[model samples]
Target: MQKHALPETVGKNIKTKLMLSATPLRRLSQATATAALGLTMLTAIGTDPAKAVNLKTFNISGNFASTALDGSIGLPVNLANGSFNGAYTVDVDQLPASNSFVNLTSWNVNLVNENTVLGTLSNSLAGNTAYIQENKLAFSDAGLLTNENKNLYSLELDFDSNFTGTGITNDGKFLDNSDLGSVKSSGLTAVTFVKIEPVPEPQNLAGTAVIATIGLWLRRKQKG
Candidate 1:
C-alpha cells in the first residue's frame, strides 16, 4: 500500500504542472481579484466623505410704526402716531439677493402703557400675552443699499391706539387710548436680527469643488 501511495503522489505533482501551463489565466485572475479587494478596502478606510460648512448671522429689526399704506397695519389710517415700540427680527439660510423678501410668520406684542393698573400694560411673556402669528401682515424685504455697502432687511409693524384715554381714568388698555386717536403707531425703539447657514447643497458642492484629484491619481497609479 505504501509503495502505491508514493507513485500516486508523484503522478499528481506531474499533472498539476501540466494544468498550470494549460490554464495560467486562472492564477492571473486570482491575483487580480485579491489586488482589487485590497484597493477597495484602502479607499473605504481613507476616503470617507464627511464635512460641514460654517454658520452665518444676520442683524434685523421690526418696525412697529409703519403705516397701513405700506401694507403693515390692517387699520385704515395711522392710529398710534407712527410710534411703534416692539422688537422683532428675521433670518434666512443665506443672504438673499435684492428684491427677495421673507414672509412674516407670527409675533407677540408686549403692549406697555405707563398708566395701566400694574404701571405697565401687558408683558408678552406673562399671562396677558397677546400674540398674532395667524395674520400674514408682517414681512421683510432687502433694504436700500447704504454707503457701507451692506444690505439690510426691513420689518414693519403697526398698531391702533384710540379706544381708551389717559385723561379720564386708567382703562388699562393703552392701545385703546384716544390721545393718539385714529393714528397708527409704527416704528422701532430697539431691534435685533440673527441668521445661520448650513452646508451647501450636493449639486452646489460638486460645482464648487476645486479638488477631485485623489481618486484620479490612485487610478492612474494602478494603471501604471
Candidate 2:
C-alpha cells in the first residue's frame, strides 16, 4: 500500500495547536513549582530560629475629665518559638483629684479572640503608690503572646478609690469602681487603643508579591 502525506495547511495547523497547548502546560508547571518553592521559603522563615525577631507594640490612651492615661504593651516574636516576653506600662498623667486618688485594685491583661480570653497576665500589683500610681507588668512565659493562637488580644485595667471621692470610671475598657458606690464615670471620658505591627523586610515583601502574582496568573489561566 502507498502512503499519502497530509496537506501542508493541516500539518501546520496541527503543529501550531500542539505547540500552543504545550506552552501553557509548561508555563503552568513552572508557575506551580515557583509557588511551591516560595511557600516553602516562607514556612522556613517562619520556623527558623536564627531570623531577626519582630515585636509588635500596641499603645492605648484614655482620658476622663483632667486625667490622661497611656498604656504600652510589647510582644517579642519569632518563627520557631512563636512565644515571646510580654511587657506593658500603664501611666496616668494629669489626673484630677477625684480620679487621681485611685488605686489599681486588680489589673488583668488578656489575649482575646472575639469574646474568648486566650491568655492573661498572671502577675498582680498592690499598694504600689499612695494616691496616683504607675504599674509596669511583665511576663516571662513565651506562650502568652503567640499569633498562632488568637486573632485579637487586649489589656484591661481595674481600679479602686484610694480616698473618698467621686468614682473613677473610664469610657473605654476600664470598668466601674465597684468599691465605691458611685456609678461609672459618664461623659467627657474617651479612650483610644492603637496596635502597631512591624513592617516586613524588602526581600520578604518581594517574595510575597511573587506568590500573589503566581496566584493571579493561575486564576487567569484557569478562566481562559
Candidate 3:
C-alpha cells in the first residue's frame, strides 16, 4: 500500500547531476544505485522502536552508495541485478519498552525499491508477544536478515533473551518487486531508511484536550 510518497526531493540534487553525464542510463544507474545503498541502512531502523529510543526524533542513516549492487548480483536478466545487503546497528534503548517485556504491540515496515510501492506487512506477535518483548535487547545488531534460498528479506535482531521463533516479520517480497524500477533504471545504488514513531493513542490526546477546554471555560466564566 502506498502510504506517504517518498520525498521526490530526496534524490533530486544527485539525480540531476547524473542526467548530465554522457553515459546512457541503464538498469541500476550509478546514481540511483548509490542512493539505494544509503537508503537501505536508514530503512532498517524502522524495523523496531529501539533504534530511536532516546531522541525526540532521530533518523538512522543508510549508506546506499556503499552497498548497492549493479546487475552482477543474482537477479533476473530483465531486472536490474543491483541487489544490496548490509547490517545496521540498532541499540536496545531504541526498542526499550517492548524489550522490557512489552513485546511488539504492533509493528510494520513499508519498503519501496525504485519508486515502486511495496505493501506493508506486520506481526501481531500473537501469543508470543511477551516472549518477543522480553527478549528484546538494546545492544544488538539489527540484521538485514535475508534468505537467498527463500527469497526472504527481513530486518531482524537477536534479543539478549531466550526465545525461539522461525519468523517474526518478513518484507522480502515487497522489496524485490516493489516499484524498484526507479532505483534500478536510475543506476543509483540506494539505501531505503524509514522513520518511525510511536502511534499515539487517541485517548491520550483526547484527555489532554478535554482538560484544556474545561480550564478555558472556567476562566471565561470567572471573567463574565
Which of the numbered candidates is closest to the native, going by highest lDDT?
2
RMSD of 1: 20.3
lDDT of 1 at 2: 55
Ranking by TM-score: 3, 2, 1
Q: What is the C-alpha RMSD of each candidate to the true structure, in Å?
A: 20.3, 22.3, 30.9
Give the per-residue lDDT of model 1 (tens digit) for 28-109. 8899999999999888878766554323221222222223333333221333222223333233332231333432222333
lDDT of 3 by residue, 1-224 (tens): 87885588877966877876646666448779889978897797666656333222212212122343454232222223222222122233434334345333334333333544232233432211112344431111113223422222333233333432221321211123212323332122333322223333478789999999999999999999
Q: Mark the regions of model 3 whose C-alpha exceeds 4 Å error after superposition.
A: 1-68, 72-105, 112-116, 124-149, 156-194, 211-224
Pitting candidate 2 against candidate 3, the one with the higher TM-score is: 3
- Displacement of the residue 216 alpha carbon in candidate 1, Å: 55
lDDT of 1 at 208: 56
Give the winner by TM-score: 3
Give the alpha carbon lDDT tens digit for every residue of 92-116 in model 2.
2223235233332223344333344
Candidate 3 lDDT score relative to the true structure: 0.36
Off by over 4 Å in 2: 47-224
